[model samples]
Target chain A: MMPEKVTIADVARRANVSRQTVSNVLNSPDLVREETRERVRQAVEELGYRVNQAARRMRTGRSRLLAVRIEQTQDGMNVFDRFLHGLTESAAKAGYRVILYSADDDRSEIATFDDLLGAYEPDAFVLTGTHYGDVRTSWLAERGLAFVTFGRPWGMPEGGDHPWVDVDGAAGTAAATRHLLDAGHRRIGFIGWPEGSGVGDDRRSGWVRALGEDAEDSEAGVLERRTDGSAAEGEAAARELIAAGATALVCVSDSVALGAMQAGPVPVIGFDDTPVAAAIGLTSLSQPLSEAAVRCVRVLTRLLEDDSPDKPDHVLLRPSLVIRRTA
Target chain B: MMPEKVTIADVARRANVSRQTVSNVLNSPDLVREETRERVRQAVEELGYRVNQAARRMRTGRSRLLAVRIEQTQDGMNVFDRFLHGLTESAAKAGYRVILYSADDDRSEIATFDDLLGAYEPDAFVLTGTHYGDVRTSWLAERGLAFVTFGRPWGMPEGGDHPWVDVDGAAGTAAATRHLLDAGHRRIGFIGWPEGSGVGDDRRSGWVRALGEDAEDSEAGVLERRTDGSAAEGEAAARELIAAGATALVCVSDSVALGAMQAGPVPVIGFDDTPVAAAIGLTSLSQPLSEAAVRCVRVLTRLLEDDSPDKPDHVLLRPSLVIRRTA
Candidate 1:
């Protein structure tokens, strides 16, 4: 049989201190006198107090739990591994444990959410690789659950109140384009994801915005646009771009960049300085995944601690350019 | 209070079947009639009669648990992730769970082993990246515990009795060398980990064996050899090789290959077609990690079920070559 859960009141009684002192010791250790904190800590250890996590959460009206829901789609593959590494490292340092959950392909969006809610009852959720018209976000929002997503939600106002952290997709692409332009390459081509895909669309916008009329008129400028994020598709896109007379190519991802390099001899740049990009010497933008993960944990922890449902916070991280032999 | 564990007898009584029939349904479903199996399964579900895993293990002298220990060193980084993924996937497919334990440092090795033994009482242990004088392997052998290691133990005989599954490190290196040879490259150089490193030594031996003694001794044929696995170290190694007139480079890992690529225009080939390798298009040898994981589970399971220590089994899987542009 499970042992009885030790409570804050029990600890306070044992330490001959008020419950508020125990609370202060738990939430803000600095505020409590060192002697008082030590006494309470001793009492906690002696009484085997474990803070009754669920009960404490109920009283604070916030959970200490954070749920990261990862979609198992093909495009979502490989990205999660790096993300997981970053998230796990950051979360561990911040004293938060992330519960990983995957959405079943056969389950409806709401059903998936329901199952997760029942299983974990996390305080807040992090939705990675969110798509257009994502129902998961709306369901959580309606239930008044604090949450954040990696990408902007569909139909949400540009400056709307909802916490999110995403890469400046357009700015990253523009940086890549400017790098090529600075290299004296005028006939630069863009091999990117298909139109209507949120992140892809943002990347294309950056390229188009950078090149302006040069991007608009020539069929040669748009080398290949694929809806998929596979190596085979990237290779096909590279071949098409090379045939169209592109002296240099800007790929949507490092994987695509590798494929492009294998497909032809044309110089290429890629996004997301994945280890592969560094390995192959592909000039690309390296996303600060570790920093973003730390920030995500910080923000989520704050929301879980405080009961206010004020304006949501949005964080946009800068992508650094890594120059290599490919470009 | 925790609910009382439902026993096989209770399940059998509810399903109107003998306890032996219930045991057959749980252990070997094929032995029971389909209708009887269905009835027993339904009874199990209704009563929530989970097999008393700990008790069953103790009675049968089979924990059905596979324990893997990884070396805790900077060079051993990333080994755990791949190994865990493979082991977990294989264990789940075979209706078992893998209990993971890690040695934080050399001092914790014995403590880690003790904790794992007491807590899980694993059926078999898999030791990866073991070094000279590894006490863990010898301890398990002395205790008469079934076990395996990725590489042969340092003090053990070449064709020893202990079961092990290993990548043909020599053959993989030879294959990489042959790829460079077939590409009409004679002035090839080797960049690898330090001599004492078992994997490094094995791979370097293959490179030397493939090129012949006289060719390997030539100044142009021997570029640079480094001890570290960091990208910076790789870059420095590559620069040294380039200065020594080495045209093509073979590296110990994808990270080194990436580092070498970042340093200059030299084409690089590496071992382990990790995700990063795929992203960078570095020609690499892809170790059969998933296959080896499955095989480990299969072997461990067989050993657990057979309940005999008469003989040990050893398996070796050949690594495959993945050709990319770096070569």
Candidate 2:
């Protein structure tokens, strides 16, 4: 059975310290002496002192809990899986736990956000896969809730007062294309998803940027192909690109590269550097997911703590090429 | 700023109803008159009524938060992602929120459980990937915590008190083997993980079981090969199995099946029917993960509700084969 509420004064008395020391121990442990911190902690534990969340909130106006939406793509790409793991590890180090929810779409996501806020009382939200004029950010921003996005607010200029972390897809694809170009391949084709997605287009741009300033046939979208981002479709697209005088290929996703690999042993580079690519020895670009996640949490904790005046608002991390047998 | 929590008494006074009626409206609306329920709900909404969790826990002991460990395999298998989605959906229906944590190993997982119990005060936990003499379960059991496993407690007897929902791996592999047998293939081979894991061995046993009940060469691991459950390793082992008279193969995982498919297009069946499997058209057994997740929550809720004596403590649901191009 839980005992009566053990106040900070009680823990302080038990530890033979001032109440402020106990407060510092709980709120900012680094501010307290190590020995005094241990003593206060032992006293708190022995006395079963638990934070009355409401009381603590009213006093310090600070807390730590983040709500994360866990999503899996229809094609079974585990892109978010690695991201979730990285975020969780980083969040734990920062004294936060993630309350996860899944929603069918953005509308339901806002609804779930409302439910989670009321039910779990998370201090902030970590939005993933953000897009242009994203409703979720606007919803939270309108309510004056603290939050950060793991994806760039597409079409929003740098330093738009929105906090986000994103991997530079164009840089990743450009690096991939450059690797192929350095290997003496002139006609490097790009395979990507339908042109509507900002991420897909970003990746396509890098491939074009890597080709010389000729930008002629490449400008015609000459050797480029788009698909629904399936391995089978990738195979077909790869075949078509190969037929059109392309000796090397750059794909927006590992799934397409997988299909492209089946099309021929011709050198190919895939994005995301997923486990599937590694297992099959495919050259690909590895997203800096872990670093990005760490930065996301860093930006978020900075906001919740409100200690820094010039808190970093946006992060665009570069992905690196993992040279393997395929390219 | 959050105001003081609006209690049931406050809502009752606002609604001009008895406190008992207000409690009934909150806990069991079915027991309250419709008109009375509407009045109490409206009053509660007007007052922004928020239950004092600690006080409510003392009175009813029927809280609803389930702690789930979010896990991602090193192989990029998203099996747990689907299971988590199913559990979240089902848990939401039952007014439960899942608090997710990820751990590196069983030891860290136990530490996370202790931390979660202290911080979240969840009513129960949903454990996945149970193994023989699992330390995690023993720790929970020792602490008298309520939990249900998504995996079976290996080596436990049929009527063991542990609550779990597990897909019948043996039956699943047996069905795959039988499908091949019905197609008139003899000397079918089995590819699985290096023989120690309970799940891997369970799948291997299914193939052995469906081998005409000969129980001779099958017992000797003849026509059977083991690998590290990777596609590259699977390919190498498949080649060996094919060389030694295996007309068809049953793989323990989709990754292995992906490898075996590269081994000369031999008829093959994989387990877990992952997204990769669907993308590549690998015939595989689909574990009824959603059904199992739903059942795990059901068992947990039943135990927590404690009104039903006939609680389904142990459940073994059979996995179904999804036929595709590979087979």
Candidate 3:
């Protein structure tokens, strides 16, 4: 037989507190005194009291659901899935639920955001693949919604206090460059996205910083930025770099690195130590995406639960470089 | 300024039908006559009437939502993600919403299914990672739930009528074997999972069928079956096969193939041409996961909208072999 369902009233009676007080302790602990909150929590756990999700939702007028907005450009891209796994695992641990929202290219970002907000009224929002001057972020900020973005904010102030978690692209690239440099590679070529993009720029800066001004200015350390994020671009960049006598190439992404490898036998390194990177033995950086995703969810949930509008928290995580045969 | 909100009453009045009829036309077309449904649909498009999701949800006992049940064990695995992306995309195109329900291994599957069904009362359901003698499928069938699964029913009669979309695993493995044979590999090795599992056994059968009975029995064609699905197990199998004088190895999955590749320089082929397989240049049979997922959602949605329990439709997509350096 199934175990009997436990209710909050059981704990409230045991703790000698009103049902409302028990509710306050669970929903908004800030409203209750620390000692009272501790007593209620202990009683609840002791009684195995589970808050009735439906009743709680009705009382608070807020669903314990968070929205994860993903772009639906590519039909079968699994990159978002990896991040989602991390987010779901973390959210489950914290007793939160995730609802997926797909952003279509044809729809205005604001329209999409409004549709989701109106339909779900999600407690908090997590966004991915945001671009420069994204209206969605600004709108959420203006509405005082608790939210966090996975990518670095574009056009935002440097070191801006915004709730976000991203791969340390610059640092990862620097480590990649240092690895090649230590491997007796002086003529290292860089294949990256066009300048002015947040991730592309960050990775490019890391390469330049590691190489120094002398190498940056010299023909030995040429940087070729791709106009688009595609393997074809990487192949072209590799051909040019090879013609320019580059012994080693560092690509901005695993796909690009793979393309460069396919174009020629020149040893190449890539970012995002994606599954492909590991399979091909391409020396690359593995971003701690799952960890970052978990952290983002945790921080955002805390903000939503506390209703804290305090200074935003920004987290930076170090990405590890996996050495493969490519470089 | 945003356009004035269009109401359902306006559409109903314009179509000269009762508001409830209009609602039925939108939500359950099977309940409305074809002529009346066309008139209501035309009125809706004319007025640009988009359902006020929150308002409609409040008025109706049902939600315009469906739940995709995913096992927690397969959370980070990319294979599930590919199917999810396809399912989500197709569901969105049909103006339906999907919520993910993570199933806990510790909980009784029936209890978990009951909880989700009672809470969400979703219009339809999609189950992932279904196995032989799946109690959930039988229970759902008994309850007459509009549901679909990812694979053919195991422990059930052949040609069992069910709404499902499955990849041609046997044909895919045969193609992989033929590719290696065409590449001048006469002494080939086969590494697969234990013979009872549906997917693993199908792949192994295909490999055996591709190599005639005489060739299959010969010392040149070695077969190694591992009870566990792990890289270490695959590596061990590969080592044994290599010692037996095999030149090429075909694995049941990409992970197993990658593991076998790590054992030595023997050409390795895998199934499910996953992202990892693509990354490492492992020649594999690429299952049409996204298409299968989309089709599953489409079929399940049809089942929900159509009140009559029509004969189940089955879709089996042919898997394509991806040629890479490994083969």
Index of the highest-DockQ prediction: 2
Structure candidate 3, residue pairs in collision: A276-B279
lDDT for B151 in candidate 3 is 83
In order, the B-chain TM-scores come to 0.85, 0.89, 0.83
How much native contact recovery, as a fraction, does model 1 achieve? 0.07
Task: Report residue B5 deviation for candidate 3 (angstroms).
Answer: 9.4
lDDT of 1 by residue, B60-142 (tens): 64555566543332332244456556776577566555544445554565665554454345567777876666676766666
Cα-based lDDT for every prediction: 0.70, 0.82, 0.74
lDDT of residue A59 for candidate 2: 46
True contacts kept of each: 0.07, 0.25, 0.18
Please state the error at residue B165 of candidate 3 in Å: 3.0
| Tens-place lDDT digits, model 3, residues A46-163 | 7666654444454454656677755452423235666776777677567666777665652465675666555555678888875676667777777667789888787775533468
Q: Residues B1-327, candidate 2, lDDT per residue (tens digit)?
A: 432446678899999999999988887899998998999999989987766544554354434678888785687754888888788888888878777788888999988876665555578999998887688887776676789999888876544557888999999999999898888887799998876688988988898888856443443368888899888899999999899888899999999998999998789999998877876678999988779888988898888886744554889999999999988
Q: Who wins the TM-score comparison?
A: 2
